[model samples]
Target: MNNSNKKRWFKKWWGILLIILCPYLLFLVILQSNLDKKKKIIFLALFGSFILFIFLITALEPSTEEKIAKEKKKQEQLKKLEQEKAATLEQETKINELENQKRKMNLEKEVKLKAETEKQIDNEIKQSSSEILLIVSNDDKLFRQDFKLMTNYLADNYSYDSILEAKKIAVNNINKSQYSIEKLKNIKCNLACNNLNEVKAVFIKLYILRIDMLKELIKFADASYGIENIATIPEEKIFRRKVIEYTEYQNKIISFFENIKAERETHE
Candidate 1:
């Protein structure tokens, strides 16, 4: 083929393949051609130079297999990194769940402890209230007995000595009730016990007031030589009022105990 025809043929896809893959066959064909010897030598030299240039470029680049292997290694590294991130995320999630569980358990424990403490305080208050009521009840009995005896004795008594004697005995018996007051006051009352303590203390104070009123009535009688109309006297009126107050306080203590008992039964 002419130079132009050869150039055109080399430009085709198969011609380029033949040049790169079958250069030896192309050389043998050139040597057998009817071309001039000098032209053949020049063409062979050029062809040899072109083959040499192709060899140098091929030697400098990596092979297809090595490129594939390197790409696969890079893909594997990316996959491993993703797996590690997923594992780390899973571990962090587990840690968060454990922390939430721990907090819930601690909160439940605190609630249980608080409820137990409150129940214990309520039980203590109940027991103490019962004891104080019994003490007051006993004191009330003693007061009633002395008051009854004094009233009966004074109904017919006409002398200062007997009236004064009755007053002394009544006053002495009333003073004995003061022991319950001291005992109640000495109790350790916390915020929970304030209501019960306050009511009981008021009841005792009213009882003491009644004692003072009785003493005043006796003093009036002693001054009048036990002949005055006791019903119309100011001291007698004051004494009656005190007795009414004492009775009201007694009712209040009773009601307080009843309410406490009702609450206990409901809880049970």
Candidate 2:
């Protein structure tokens, strides 16, 4: 027969039947043969050993159900790993979003704080400017006129009041200047008005000093009244020196205030 047309022994129906009956046929033949007892026993042992070998092979080999179970377990593990990875990614995204929100809140807080600080500075500037102006205006109107009168008395001899009357007026001016000092002390100052109140205080003190000097001069004139005809008063020389000093300081204060006003306007 051609090889292509030939049937394999294991594939034929009779070959399969023969394979199934082989062990039984051998057992029957061993029993029927006129063999010695020892030989029969030996053949039976060999057949039992063959059967044991086949049983061990079938027991040790993996079944279809076990293989399927193992593959299913591997798939479950892969699915669990995928789920854990997705969960980790989601957690990272949430953390990033929270961090962004935190940064945004911090930025807004900084802006609000800056605005509040700027507003506070503006209020201080306005308050300081207004108070400083008020003080300067009051000084010019109230104290300056009295100061001029005292200076005139020191400069001229007879156009003004008598020595006794001038002395009384000088005392009055001193009291008024002292009062102005107290009033100026009450007005609080700010950062922009640094040393301003102190400057005004010094000016008032100088005013009082000049007035006191004038009083002394008037007293001297009164003491020498009718005893001798005084041509030039000695105290007038000292009083003129004080007047020059006062005028220079007054000019400095005026310039200082002008500069302050200009600076304040720039802020506006």
Candidate 3:
């Protein structure tokens, strides 16, 4: 049957049922009236049962409007929660993407820096090798020239005993010499004048002569075989020993010259 007709029919029958049940319940109550306590109890039970039945029927048949309203409210709440969840997920995804980008950028920077460092090290090694080759080539010629000049000058002016005396004199003179550019200019002049000047020039020359000679001597010493007999002669022994001591002094002069050259190059 149609919904309206069914509702009307149920409403009419429900009222009739209540009326019929109520009279029977009232008769029970009246029969128990002589027992006052029983009468009260029976009336209370009937009232409670009637109310309970009415409530059950009303709950069983809710209006379509109310059911639809409840369902709509639940759907709206679910939609709001879903939107919030989606927004949260989107935010998390964005954060993850940003983090990934940052990591990639850092890795790229690190790789770039490492490449630059390796390039710098390679350049430094190339420069150092070139410098070593240049020094080796020039030093041999300079050393030989200086050695010949110093030995000749020493042999002409001083006896072996006199060379020792000159050394003492040089030690004293070193203290008097001022360590300045103007003083160095004066020393150059002074180095050409008297017996001391001759001795000083020879000493300075001898100092430069010893670098290659000392390196050779050290190599010979480190070799498995002993130094050659020709290299071990008394004269050769004295010359080599003298050059070894002189090389120490020459190294300081060489370092000074190098510093001056470097400064000039830098300014240029």
Evaluated with TM-score, which candidate comes out highest?
1
lDDT per residue for candidate 2 within 85-148, as digits (tens), equals 9999999999999999999999999999888867766676666556656665675676577656
- Among residues 3 or more apart in sequence or in different chains, the pairs in candidate 1 whose N, CA or C atoms overlap within 3 Å are none
Deviation from native of the Cα of residue 114 in model 2, angstroms: 1.0
Q: lDDT values of the candidates?
A: 0.71, 0.66, 0.51
Worst 10 residues of 3 by lDDT: 176-185
- Order by lDDT, highest first: 1, 2, 3
- TM value for model 1: 0.63
lDDT of 3 by residue, 110-196 (tens): 999989876654454334333432443354355455456545544543344433443333333233222221232244221213432
Q: Runs in model 1 with CA error above 4 Å? A: 1-66, 157-162, 189-191, 198-202, 205-208, 218-233, 257-268
Q: Could you tell me how far off, in angstroms, the CA of residue 16 lies in candidate 2 after the best superposition?
A: 16
Residue 216 of model 1: what lDDT? 66
Q: Measured by TM-score, how close is model 3 to the native structure?
A: 0.43
Per-residue lDDT tens digits for candidate 1, residues 1-268, read: 4764554554568867887897676786678666899999999999899889999999978899999999999999999999999999999999999999999999999999899878877876766666666676677677778777766666654455556767787668656756667777776656457666675676567667766667665666655564545555565566557656666766766776567656655555
- Residue pairs with colliding backbones in model 2 are none
- Candidate 3 off by > 4 Å: 1-41, 52-64, 145-268
